[model samples]
Target: MLLNLKNIYKNYGKEPLIVPVLKDISLEVIQGDYVAIMGPSGSGKTTLMNIIGCLDRASTGTYLFEDEDISEMNDDALSDLRLNKIGFVFQNFNLLSSETAQENVALPLIYAGIHKEERNHRADVALSKVGLQDRTTFKPSQLSGGQKQRVAIARALINHPRILLADEPTGALDQASGKQVMELFKALNDEGVTIIMITHDASVASHAKKILHIIDGEIIENKQGGAA
Candidate 1:
């Protein structure tokens, strides 16, 4: 398995005033798996995504990423793990308006202490892979909804992460743009990229090979999917 979670639990506030957000969540994602976690707002999908992406720690659980127990890693180790092994795509497209597509894609490399030349070259290659070669120099403001999302995808792939964590990736786009983004995701998944997408849209979730329905912080369904 590429990722494994066992008996995961998440709670907020003090013990006497504990508010649980997740309960007994266990999941396994093997290499090349294309999984969608479908849930509406307040269903705790984002909280789960954060834990999977290493952005937040679970209140209690064992998370094994690539067979390494992430629950035992320290803060710095978790940061490095997230930087090198996981890539995140947000619904907002999270790009800097002042930076070009290439620059936005190269930001992760910069944080990893990569030299500027190599970062630019690799950024170009990543953008081209996502069919955004012509938009390398374009700023976020200059791109359309679909193009912006493509840039986000290119940025997420620049590090060659083993897993892609996308949270509501198509939420901000039009129907046509959302379809385009989903097509891109399908292409990436077909190319053997392990993708875990969190979305509320059933049509959007249908692009994945498997569907995991998360309701009220619990996974209530798991099955082969083609709901589009």
Candidate 2:
């Protein structure tokens, strides 16, 4: 299994007035699986994604990612795991406003100690894969919303991560741009990238091969082969 989460729970605040976000969440994901998580606002889906992406730990329960226990990993270890094993795409693009698309996509490779030439080459290849070859030198200010998201996607792919976690990737885009991004995600999944996306829109969730509907911190529905 690529991911195995069992009886996970997340709580906040002190004992006097605590809030539980996730409740006994158990999930399993295999390699190359395209999964979507859908829920209303404040339904704890974000919290669950954080744990799966190694950004946060569960308050209780065991999380075994690729059969390795991640619950006990320290902050540095978690950072390494996120940097080397997982790729994240966010709704807001998250690009440095001053950096060119090429530079932004190559940033992760820089942290990995890759040579500048190789980093630039790989970044270019990734951007080309996302069909943004002509926008390599364009800064975020110069690109459209779809182009910025494409740049973010290219950056996520630079490390060749085992799994991709996209948080509302289409949320900040217009209808046409959102459709373009979803198609890109499907194409990436078809090429064997394990993807987990979180969205509130049913149409967006329908793009996944499987859907997990979350409500009140619990998984209310799990369906495969997309929606009927």
Candidate 3:
């Protein structure tokens, strides 16, 4: 399994005022899986995604990523796992305002100790894959919302991560732009890139091969063959 979470629970605050976020969450995702997690605001889906992406740990649970116990890893280890194994896409694009598209895409490679020459080459290739090769030198301000999101996607994939975790990827786009992003996601999934996307929109979720509906800190439904 690429990922496994058993009896997961997350809570915050002190003993007398503990606020539960996720409750008894158990899930398994294998290689090449394209899954969507659908939930309304305050449903704990973001917390679950944080755990899956190694950004946070469950208050109580067993999480195994590629057979390695995540609970046993330290912050540095978890950070390393996140840097090397997982790619994250956010609704806001998260690009450096001063950096060009190529520079933004190559940011992760800098931390990986890749030389400048190789970093630029890899970033260009990633941009090409996302159909943004011609926009490599453009800054975020120069691109449209959809183009910016594509740049984010290319940056996320630049490291060739084991899984792509997208949090409301299309939430910031217009109807047409969102449709284009979903089509790109489908293409990436078809190429065997595992994807786990979080979205409240049913139309956005339908792009995945499987959908997990979350409500009240619990998974209410697990539907298969979500894609049309």
Candidate 4:
């Protein structure tokens, strides 16, 4: 298993006001699997994604990545896992406004201590993969909504992460641009990049091979389908 969760639980606060988000949740994702998490707001989908990406720990329960227990790892270890193993594409293209596409994509490698030349090389290759090779010098402010999200995708891919975690990746784009982004995701998945996308749109969720429906903090359905 590339990812596994066992009886994961999350709660906020203490005593009478404690709000439990996930209740005895368990899940597994294998290599090359394209999974989509579907749910309405407040259904713990984001919390589940955070735990899977190692951005947050489960309040209780075990999380294993490639059979190693990550729930007990230190902050630095989790940070390393996040930086080297997982890639995140957010709904809001989280690019630095002042930085060019290449610079923003190079940020992760910089943190990894890669040399500048190699960093730029990797960033350039990732940009090329996203079909944005010509826009390497453009800042986020100068790009269209679709282009900015593609830049974010390039930044996420620069590290060659094992898993791609996208949160509402097309939410900010118009229908046409959103379809373009989804096409990119499909191409990436065909090349064996495991993806776990979170979205409320059924049309968007159709892009994955597996659809997991969450309701009231629990997984209520698991559907298998082709890409949209």
Which one wins on TM-score?
3
lDDT of 4 by residue, 17-88 (tens): 999998888888999999999988999999999989998888898999999899668999889889999999
Q: Each candidate's lDDT (Cα)?
A: 0.92, 0.92, 0.93, 0.91
Which scores greater on lDDT, model 1 or model 4? 1
Worst lDDT 10-window in candidate 4: 219-228
lDDT string, candidate 2, 96-166, tens digits: 99999999999999999999999999999999999999999999999999999999999998999999999
Which parts of model 1 have CA positions greater than 4 angstroms off? none
In candidate 2 the C-alpha lDDT for residue 164 amounts to 96
Predict model 1's lDDT versus the native.
Answer: 0.92
**On TM-score, who's better, 1 or 3?**
3
Query: Regarding lDDT, does 2 or 4 come out ahead?
Result: 2
Q: Backbone clash tally for model 4?
A: 0
lDDT tens digits, residues 112-142, model 3?
9999999999999999999999999999999
Q: Which candidate achieves the best lDDT against the true structure? A: 3
- Ranking the candidates on lDDT from highest down gives 3, 2, 1, 4
lDDT, residue 92, model 1? 95
* C-alpha TM-score for every candidate: 0.96, 0.97, 0.98, 0.97
